[model samples]
Target: MKSRSPLVNRITIVVCAVVLTSIVSMATTLAVSKSIEGNATAINLAGALRMGAFRLLAQAAGPGDNHNTAEPNISSFLDKYEASLFDRLITRAIPRTADHPLTNQYRAITSYWETTLRPGLENHPQGSPVSVEMHANTETYVDSVNQLVSMLERRTEARIGLLHLIQIISLAFSILIIVALFVDLRNRVLKPLRKLVSIAGAVGEQDFSQKANMTGSDELAQLGSAFDQMSSELALTYYELEERARSKTEELEKSHAALQLLHTASRNLFANHDLCSGAVPMLQELEELLGIGPIRLYLHDKEAAEPVEVVTTASTDRPFYCRDHHCNACLVSPEDYDELPIEDNDGRRLLLPIRTPGKLLGTLEVWYPAETGLSDTARRLLEILSDQLATAIFLERQITEEQQLTLAEERTVIARELHDSLAQSLSYLKMQVARLRRLNIEGDQKSAHESILEELSTGLNSAYRQLRELLATFRLKLDTPDLATAMRKTIEEFSTRLGKPVGLNYNLPPQALSPNEEIHTLQIIREGLANAVKHADATEVIVEILFESPQVKAKIRDNGKGLPVGEQPVNHYGLVIMQDRARTLGGQIVVKNRDSGGVEVILTFVPKSRHLIPTEAPST
Candidate 1:
């Protein structure tokens, strides 16, 4: 947690070591270089001294006039030579030992130059030819100068070698320091950093158990400690979250299973005949779902407003829920939702209302041991089961009521059919008989009586035919409950009987129309087919039932001679009966002659999804 960085200090130390090594190398080099600084100049001056000796020799050998031009040149050159010999570059390069080779040679050269060469050049006669002795002295001086130049070069070369040695040592020291710094960084920083990187990678992969585990008080150690703490915290938090998630997962799984079981129960309830038939198995499933005790179901008639039936689990040998007179259901209306807090020698009893929207139809009573208590989950499940039970019972009752209403409506239609066709024929026959009786009484019972009798016979036969048609129409209900199946069979039968191709184009969804709508629609098609069979005298027939949303349309076409223009079929009430059925279904039918020489019977109606209940808003 400190803001201290040891790496900075370590780098500072390394830099200082390198800089110090460089400074020492430079100082050593500077000393050695100072020792050899002017050796090159000294070597050049020594060579020049040798050349001056040659000039002095040449001057001594020349004629008197040549000496006149060269006397001042030799004197000036000798004077400069003396001054340069004792200058800093030459004199300051003195060796420590008095007998050192370079120093001795330097002194010899200086003495020779001052003692022999200078005097020879200065004191010689002007313009005199140089003697052989003077030339020999000059040669000796040139030799000394060459030896001095060689010694100066050797001395300068030695100092240069020392300077190189210092530089080499400085480079080695710097290299050593840099290598040490790298090793230190590897041990102190780089290794730890690599470990931290690996740990960070592990953490990214949800492996929070990995730790940097670095020791010491360096920056990396502190970073590692902080990282480890973070990892620990993350581990704890993740573990807690995992526990909670696991628990929640268990709850969700249980809820899913319960919902699946409840769904299966509901499917069995509705898929079977009625609630009473499947009630025992449903109650047992509810018991298994809740882990509770025996359950009972009571049925109530909303119309009669009394408890009508009781169905319970087969587990109990006796009447567990109630005795006939001890039942508390009398205290509550069939539509009441109040709880029946009935407890008996059996145990605690819980009652769930089996109800639909705005109506209570029955109750599901569960009796459990007194020690066993229901959880909120189980109680909620029971409520849902009760709702499903209510829905199934309510739907079944609705189907029964619809079938009864349909039956009554059809019976009324049949009565109207009898009145319109068969009853009219019977009345006509009665009149004919009365006329026949009058003829017999008047003793004119010859051809007139026979005609009246023939008329009566025709009326009776017509009545009998109408009666048969009515029986056939009624028999359709017992034969095939499904309208499509009945229509298919009818089409096949008519094709077989008429010896003509009969096509059925049924395009309606099965659930689009109610049972009543289907019945009326199928019967209208049958009536059209019947009329065609009796009188159409045609070749082909086509029956089509189609649905456009909110509407069902049926068409029965026969390639048969249509009815006489504006006239009904004689002694037949098919059209009247079809009109009655269509009216009952809140639809219309048209029976007319096709333009292509046939009868076309088309009926269209809005199908009822429910029993014509007047709702405030239409359900989508």
Candidate 2:
């Protein structure tokens, strides 16, 4: 909670200041003491030299010469001489022994007296050149005093100069220390702290989007780490909440779509319509609603000795049978219903039984991988879909039976009309022609004539048109053709009608296209040509058909003025009709503009029987 930086800084400053002050005080005191000692030493040396020279001159001049004043002069000179000698020795030796500034001055004065005064006094009688010698000593003393004073002044100046230099150095060092302290605070502590504060402020504002670039393994880095932890936690929490909300929304959507499909399927099945046609649509809606990969159907046989023995499938050409004779469901009872995993090179398979109150249909087998196994909810939905599909199948069988009865009645009526109209007319015409020939033989042309000829021609044209219509109907009623040839024929018809350069190319192996595929291909080709004529101003057309092992394909190309892809025209029912036909046959239609200034319509045909392998009938 408490920081030590400020306190540490304050103590450092105080210590530095105290050390600098002490150094300055010591330097100044030493300088002043040296200056005072130099000045005092110069003055004392000059005074001692003066006294010794005066006393020595008096001593040499007295003693029985100038008899009356001799004794008194001699006594006074001797006393002065003794006192000067004492003063001279003490000033010179004592100062030198003490090692004071006066020692140098005393030695200089002693040399001056000995060189000029002492030699002159010893060379002549005591009183012989006393005044000259005394004058010389006095001059020498004055010169020596001037020189000593100058030396003392120079010494004092040097000491003061040293003191000034020391003070300057101390002040400079103190200022440098203070500047360094300020710089350290700015670079190391204060700047980093400010950076941390800015980063924290940004984070507090919910801006975990940006990060701090703090470096080093310092305390600031630790703070940066803490900030990172908080930011990461907040970001993770927000992401988790967002994901949960999204998941719930998606689940709700799926549930609503599933319920809607159930409602629609129920309505369609109960209606008195073609249930076979409706069942496919219902299954497709269910597939889209529940995101089913693929779907199939297996039905129980009502006309067989046993339902399982003669099971049927929604696939027109396929008969249903159990997966090997001894499959896991072979002896499975209703209460013991379970799923068995079947693995093959293609993928995994799941075999589920279709059961009602007291009857069992052929098992509904699905092929999917292990990872994408049916969930319980999905299985339940499938169960519902399967039940609904069975009811629809039952209704469709009923519709088929009724349609068969109605078709038989219509055939009988058409046969009757053919017999009544054409046969009776032919019979009457024969008799009339027979009588006309007899008249011609007898030369009677007035009663016979153009009436018979015109009537015959009219009836013949009518008969021809009726025959063409009948042939068209019969072609439609016959079994579905081989898809490859059917597609080619349709394309050729379109080319003739359009009077354009058109061609059909098929890519299938011989006899590979199945019955359902043949019909679908025919429908697709017919629709594609109709589309080309209406939408594409095509001059050259090409129809390509391919029947591979797994799927059938028809690609129609035309060099024409291309239309915008996927932009369905408002009144364009032709393309919609094509798409509807494809959907009915469980196929897809894709239209796009080809590179060579043309439109290409692709029809992909997946035969329902490919996924539904037929079961061989049992040997009687």
Candidate 3:
């Protein structure tokens, strides 16, 4: 295995390069500056030496008679010049060689001072002629020293130019190094980091297809590898979770479909009051839901002592026979047949017992292919269907019985009404005819004969009126479900039959009366209207039905001659019947003459059954 340099090392290298370059640049600058400073010192020393030599020469060349006075000044100038020259040579560290131009000049000047000028100046007195030679030599030495100073100045200028060049080069190199570092950082660190950021953002959005294709022996590469692993694991986990959710959803859908099928079948079975009308559709629904067809339903006819096939899906010529034991098997122990389907030649049959709480109504037989047996779910659904069918059948039978009982009760009422009104009236007429025949044979008084005839006529008229009232009561029909509409019809019938205006002010709440209450109320109103038309001979009649909580009131008023001023007609059969109806409704009826000069019949009742009270008023 091979190891590469880490990011830190690479960065360190770049920093070190910058620092090293800076150090080198500074060193070069210091070297150049020191060299220029040394050259400046040399130039200054040389100039001083030249100035001292000129002074010595000038003093030496003074008037010959003043040579004694100028001697000390010339000696002082020589000493100063020697000191400046020695200082320049020592400071410059230049050898006395002729290899370099400035060095050779300096060495020549030093040799001239040491070997000739110094020897002459020291050997000859200041006032002697030898001093003249000394002045000339000093002037030449000053000129040479000036020439050396010029050369040193030129050298210092060249060194300054070299320093400027080095500084410029160093600056350019530093800039290039910085640019390289920036480019390297962008390529190696910033770009890859940006890619990682983008990848992370993609991962957050649940898109895992993209990968960090970063390549290096760096930490970012290792991080990318870890990220890829995490993404792969997360994707795999998500796939597994999705598959589980899909499977669970499928299971839930299946359960819901079964429940819906059962619910629909139950609704269809109970929706129809007559089970025979709904049984075919229910069987078809069951066949569809169970994925099997050819269903037959057999209901036991206890009166006929046989099983009747009420509904069947299959068209077969062969009749289905129910044996004694088969009916008993369903009725006695339903659980025995719940485990498995019964095998048959055409297919398998599942015999489910249709039973109510205590009675076995019938058996439901479902036929399926032999290869496909009944599933537990199918069996369970079949049991539920059978239960619903049993319930529907039970309700149907109960409703049929109730209808028959209501018809019987109505017949008994009609018989009683005939016996009470028509039978008694006819018996009276027969007796009157017998008496009239006897009186005619005996040849009685004319007044007595007229009275008998008049009585007969009145009796005949009253009997005819009672008969008409009975016919009207029997003819009354409810065209709509609303009690208000029924009341209006009753009022209209009376108005039309009596040839009198009948007005109905109906303000009762809908559904406030049960079927029994409605019937009794209608009859009572009919009786009241009949009395108004027959006895009152009213010109106008008004019927009012008012509803209050827990009680209903009906009022009938006629604008006719008030009741006779005598005992009430308590024994009148019509009035007695009206009172009976009111008693049956747990209420009472009152008949009185209005104070304003008419007859008024009022009936008030608290409904017998609270459960039968309707929530809203009947629609007219």
- Which regions in candidate 2 have their CA more than 4 angstroms from the true location? 1-106, 110-132, 215-218, 221-620
Per-candidate RMSD vs. true structure? 22.4, 23.2, 21.5
Weakest ten-residue segment in model 1 by summed lDDT: 611-620
Q: Candidate 2 lDDT, tens digit per residue, 1-620?
A: 97655436555775767586666667676756644553455445545545555555656654436656535544464455435534643443233454655456656655665675556545446565467646666567756756655655565566667777777776777777678767866765687778778767876786666555656555656666676676778778877888878865765676677767877777877783433344456655655555443344555543334333222222323223322222222233433222322243233555566655576645555544466555555567667766765665556545554554555466557656766776577667656655655654324654456466556655654454444333332243212123443454565667777887578665443223344445445656766776676568888888777543346667888888887756665434556657887898787999888888888988876566433222443321
Q: Candidate 3: how large is its RMSD?
A: 21.5
TM-scores for all candidates: the values are 0.38, 0.36, 0.40
Please give the distance, in angstroms, between residue 465's alpha carbon in candidate 1 and its true position after superposition. 0.7
Best-first order by TM-score = 3, 1, 2
lDDT of 3 by residue, 1-620 (tens): 86655777788888898899899999999988876766766777778777776665555555445446644555666687677778854456453455988788878888988998776665555544545567678778778878888888788888889999999988988998899999988987898788788878988998887777767877777777777787888788888899878865764565567678768767767776534445655566656656675677788653334555656654422122211111221122335323223353446777888888788888888877677666666777677778878888788666654653574468567856887878677778867776775664345577787776777766666665666566556545543323666787787778897897698877654334556677788989999988888789788899988764446889999988989998765335688778999999999999999998789999999765332232234322
Worst 10 residues of 3 by lDDT: 321-330
- The whole-model lDDT of each prediction reads 0.70, 0.57, 0.70
True-structure lDDT of candidate 1: 0.70
Best candidate per TM-score, number?
A: 3
Clashes in model 3: which pairs?
509-617, 509-618, 510-616, 510-617, 510-618, 511-614
Residue 50 lDDT in candidate 3: 70
Instruction: Compose the digit string of candidate 1's lDDT tens values, residues 380-487.
Output: 877888888888888876776577467857866786787688767777776767676566445666777677677667767766676766656655652222355667
